[model samples]
Target chain A: MTEQLVIMVLLSFLVVIAFGIILLKDLLVAVILSGIYSLTAAAIFVVMDAVDVAFTEAAVGAGVSTIFLLGALTLTRRQQKQQKHNNYFALLVVTLTGALLIYGTLDLPGYGDGQSIANQHPQLAQHFLQKSEDEIGIPNVVTSVLASYRGYDTLGETVVVFTAAIGVLSLLGLRRRKREEDPELDAKRQCRQQNEEV
Target chain B: MKYLALYNYWIVVIIMMAGFYIMIARHNLVKKIIGLGLFQTGIFYFYVSLGKVDGGTAPIFVESLEAQATVYSNPLPHVLILTAIVVGVATMAMGLALIVRIYEKYDSIEEDEIKAIERQHWQENNGEFGISLTAPPTASS
Candidate 1:
């Protein structure tokens, strides 16, 4: 009962944070609140016993992304300007989609139903969970599945991460060729990069 | 009982729809990206909830096989979500980088302002403006 109460409290806090992210006009406050939102989400994930996911949420969502958002803010305005156009069209689309989503949820099995299709027909999952100790010798099924059974997927994910990093570097990283062509522009670029670094 | 059982999933749906609303309604590019992050987080929660068993413990094995027979939360979703979380961060980083470049080129990050600038360029170049449209005005001169 106490656990349920704690979950309820955390869930309500999450709702508040989500609303703060949406309703806040100041981009900086929203950004900081978004980080808090991630932290709260991580806490909720922890309560749900997803320690790995909670760790990643804390590290990536709250840690790295917050810094990156601040970096992006440095180059952009800190406030969201009052939108001049009516968002009625957006409201209509959002309402339609949200209703459709709610309708689809009606068919979904209840939370934590062990006999549900996803949990019952666990052919692949069974292989990983049951045989993981003998085959891969890892205590953590998540690690074994990630590193062994789904090794190729992990490799692809790594490649995706590498590709994204390369894309960012090409887009915003210092350019040797451009720097060589114009010394004055190079100096300005250096100053900005130094400021960002600090 | 049914409503209580499905309450968590309903919350997930609400959060997801809220993220979708933000993505659609917000004009600021940064806010749009933030909305996308929230949407992805909602998905992670959905998948994780699917893996949670009513009385299962974390998916860590102990010494004995008989002990391992105890119900364990499905680890598959957790593994998948780990990869997704990393990928989400990388995508967000790349998006922020692109936003930085856009700010540098347009001197404004507002979507409408960026669109207006593009429209002006198209008129000046007779609709032939392409990648060069991103060039700073001073650079073109």
Candidate 2:
């Protein structure tokens, strides 16, 4: 019971942090707030007993991505430019989509219900739980399923990561190879040009 | 009581919407990428919440002869989400790279300013605001 209460409080705090990220004007502050938001969400995941997910969220969402975003921030303006007109259309679209999602949630099984279709079904999940220990001889069902049962899917995900890495490298090429082709150098030249024009 | 039973999923829905709102309303390219990360995390939370079983523990096994009857949380969603988190980070890196390039060429990362600059260049070159699919033959051609 106390665990549930703690989860509820943490979940509410997460909602507040998400709102803070959306409403804050200073882009640098917003980036930092987004990192905090990831850490808080990871805490909530830990309370829910999703320790592995929490670990990934801490390492990827909070640690690496925050550093990547900060590095990107140095290349752009610190503040977001204000628009002349309000984004009413965007607000309307988001509201309608959110309402639809809430309406769709009405039919979902109750939280943590053991008899839910996903849990009660004796197909893939059951096979993993029952046979994983004997077949794969691994105690951690998630590790067995990820590394053995869904090995192909994991391979595809790894490939996707590799492709994304290649794309980023091509866009923001290596610094030592061609300093003249680098955009950071181009940005410096443009800055000097602007000063001369002024 | 029924609402309490499903409060977890509702929280997931609300967080998902907040992320969507940020992705749509924010003009900053980096913030949009951050919103994308939030949206993906909300999705992970939803799946992980659904996988939870009442009175169940984490899926790791204990060494005992009587370990057969232990109820463990579903591990499928955790595996899927583990893969997803890695992919999300990689995608965000790609997005930030593109944003850097956009900032370099346009001299601004503001969406409106970039659009205005493109429009001015288009008018100057094509003599109108639309693309010219049919090319006028050049001297070499």
Candidate 3:
């Protein structure tokens, strides 16, 4: 009961933060609030027995992503520009989507029902939990499943991360090459000015 | 009790829609990326919630399994979501890098302003291919 109450409070905080992120014009504050949002979500994850996920959310979502946003902010404007026209179309679209999703959830198993299909699926979740000790020899099912059973997925995820790093480096690296070329451009400009004077 | 059971899903829907609305309605590129992060997190929440069992513990194995039967929350979703969280951060980083490059090119990070600048360039160039090639790179405005 206490656990549910705590989760309820944290989830409420998440809603409030979501509203804050939407309504606030200051990007820096929004970024900080997003970190708080991730931390709150992490807390909820912990309550839901998702400790590993909570760890990753706290580290990656709250830590690295916040730093990335802050680094980007140094390069871009902090204030969101005010537009003349209201976005009623966006509001309507969001409302419609939310209503549809909520209606769909009515058919889903109740929260934390142990016999839910996802929990009892013999081939997938059950197979991992029951056989991971014998096949993978790892007590932590998530790690075994991630590193052994789903090795290809983890490999692909690593490749994706590496590609993103390379993409970011190449995208931001253009400035350094342009900087190296500046002396030549400056010298050429000086020659043009001198020739004009002559 | 029926409605209460679906509370988590309802919250997830709200958060996802908030992110979706921010992504589409906001002009700021950074804000849009933040919205994208929120949207991804909402999905993560849904998966994790699905894996939850009323009385189950985390998926780690116990020392004495034969002593007492234990219920472990589904580990598959946790594994999937772990990979997803990493991918999410990578996407955010890539998006921010693109935003920086866009700012450097057009001197603005707002989507509508960037579009307006591009349109102006298109009109000035009259459908030519060398739009950015002709204009000297300007310092940050």
Candidate 4:
């Protein structure tokens, strides 16, 4: 009962933060609100017994992403432009889609049901829980599953991260080089060009 | 009580839709990226919620394994969502980088203004081409 009450409070906080993110015109405040949202979600994850996920959420979602956004803000405008008109079409579409999703959830297994298919699936979750100690010799099932069972997927994910880093470097690195060029060197190059023209 | 059982899922849906709305309706590129982050977090919440089991604890095994049977919540979703969270951050970084470049090119991040500029450029080029083709046709006629 207490657990449910705690979760309820956190989830309500999440909902309120989401609304804040949507309605706030100041981009900076919106970004900070998003960080709070991530932290609140992390707390809920902890209450739900996903401590590892909660840790990662706190680190990446609340920490790195917020910093990345603040850095991006330094390069872009801080205030969103006033929209000329309300986007009724988008509102309608979002409402309909949300309604359909809510309808789909009507038949889902109740929260924390131990007999749910996902929890009892023999081949996937159960296999990991049962055999991870013997096969991988790792007590932590998540580590064994992530490193030994899903090693290739993690490798692919690493590759994806590497590629993203390279992409960001290539995209923003050129401007940094141009901005950092020495003024004396620029003048020297111009002088050389003028001498050549004469 | 039955209806309350699915409360977590309902909230997840609401959060996800809020992000979706922001992504589609907001003109600011940074806000759109933030929305994308929120949407990803909501999906993460859904997955983590699915992995929960009543009376279960975290997936880490204890030192004394023989004393009592321990029920650990499903670890698969944690693994999957861990990978997803990292990947989502990567995607956000890439999106932000693209936004930075777009701002550099267009001097504005708002989608409507950029579209208007592009439309003006298209009209200018099309008008030149149409004038040349119609001039020849009218002279021949």
Candidate that scores best on DockQ: 3
- Place model 1 in a CAPRI quality band: medium
Deviation (Å) of B84 in candidate 3:
0.5
* Greater-DockQ candidate between 1 and 3: 3
Model 2 alpha-carbon drift over 4 Å, by segment: A176-198, B64-68, B127-141
Chain B TM-score of every predicted model: 0.87, 0.85, 0.89, 0.86
Q: Which pairs of residues collide in model 3?
A: none
Q: Per-residue alpha-carbon lDDT of model 4 for A110-180, expressed as tens digits?
A: 88888999999999999998888889998888889889999999999999999999999988885453322
Q: Which is the better candidate, 3 or 4, if ranked by DockQ?
A: 3
- The models' CA-based lDDT, in order, is 0.78, 0.79, 0.86, 0.84
Winning candidate number (lDDT)? 3
What is the clash count for each candidate, in the order shown? 0, 0, 0, 0
Error at A6, model 2, angstroms? 1.6
Q: Give per-residue CA lDDT, model 4, range B86-122, as digits (tens).
A: 9999999999988876665445677766555455445
lDDT of 1 by residue, B1-141 (tens): 777666667677777777887888887889988888888888888888888777777788777745445887778889899999999999999998888777665555677666665665577667766425345545653
Model 3 agreement with the true structure over B28-53: per-residue lDDT tens digits: 99999999988999999899989999
Better of 3 and 4 by TM-score: 3
Q: For candidate 3, what TM-score does chain B get against the true chain B?
A: 0.89
What part of the reference interface contacts, as a 0 to 1 fraction, does candidate 4 reproduce? 0.78
Q: State candidate 3's DockQ.
A: 0.53
Candidate with the greatest TM-score versus the true structure = 3
